[model samples]
Target: MTDDVTAAPRIVVGVDGSDPSKAALWWAVREAGLIGGVVEAVAVWEYPTAWYGWTPPQAEVFDYEKNARRTLVESIDRAIGPDRPVEIHTRVVQGHPAAVLLDAARGARLLVVGNRGHGGFAQALLGSVGQHCAQHASCPVVIVRGPGEASND
Candidate 1:
């Protein structure tokens, strides 16, 4: 929320290619349009920590960053479409989802995230990433619910 005339305000959003994330991206875009700001759609990826005995060689390792980028783009396309009303930036980072989002929201006008993501607890109202960002983001935060997401049930 700077007064600098040259740079448009920035609204950072966390996208994980999940339905909830898609809704969060859509809401971020519309909010940016309302404030004449730009959207930063961020997707974070990290190596799987569950594998202990079987480790893939570097040659056989999966391209997580590339897949993350593709997923982010696909989510954007599905959520906001090709015809964007406001400027949208996509960033793929390698780190914890909540930490990455909190860092990205630095100096931003606002931070947006989904109520839930691809977590093990399917019935949870808020996922860890969203909850962490809500508690730690330097700027204001918005947690958006995906289509047909129920509450008070």
Candidate 2:
């Protein structure tokens, strides 16, 4: 971590509005409070590709960002409640989940994420987001698991 007092220590966390992601957010908040760092909650979104060569309306296409931001806020509220003591900054980025999280983790002390997300492969131990961030993030990565989730490693 940077020792510069001018900058607030930051811990970046990737959130996908999933249960494990919410747990990761809460864990990050607690760690931030312990270390005097602020938590950066990042939610990534992109316009869905249309099937059968059909395109959605422009308004509908742009609504994903708004929904992502809403989801991030709700996750934060659910995890830490409205009167959280630690400072939390929320971001909605447009790109792949791992790429967006890596960008956000550039200057962070730690990058945190959930073990799995809303992907179809629910039985997997780790989802692509967690695996990618752990492998490629600039800072150290912490993969938070839910209460009932056990580590296979």
Predicted model with the maximum lDDT:
1
**Candidate 1 residue-wise lDDT, 20-136, digit = tens:** 999999999998999899999999998776478454567576889999999999999999988999999889999989999999999999999999888658888888888888899
> Model 2 — TM-score against the truth?
0.87
Local lDDT at 1 for model 1: 54
List model 2 lDDT by residue over 48-140, tens digit each: 668875765574336788899999989898888989889998889998899989999998999999989987588988899899999998999
After superposition of all CA atoms, the RMSD between model 1 and the true structure is: 2.5
* lDDT agreement of model 2 with the native: 0.88
* Count of backbone collisions in candidate 1: 0
Q: Each model's C-alpha lDDT?
A: 0.91, 0.88
In model 2, pairs of residues that clash are: none
Angstrom error at residue 118, model 1: 1.0
User: lDDT at 131 for candidate 1?
Assistant: 89
Off by over 4 Å in 2: 1-3, 50-62
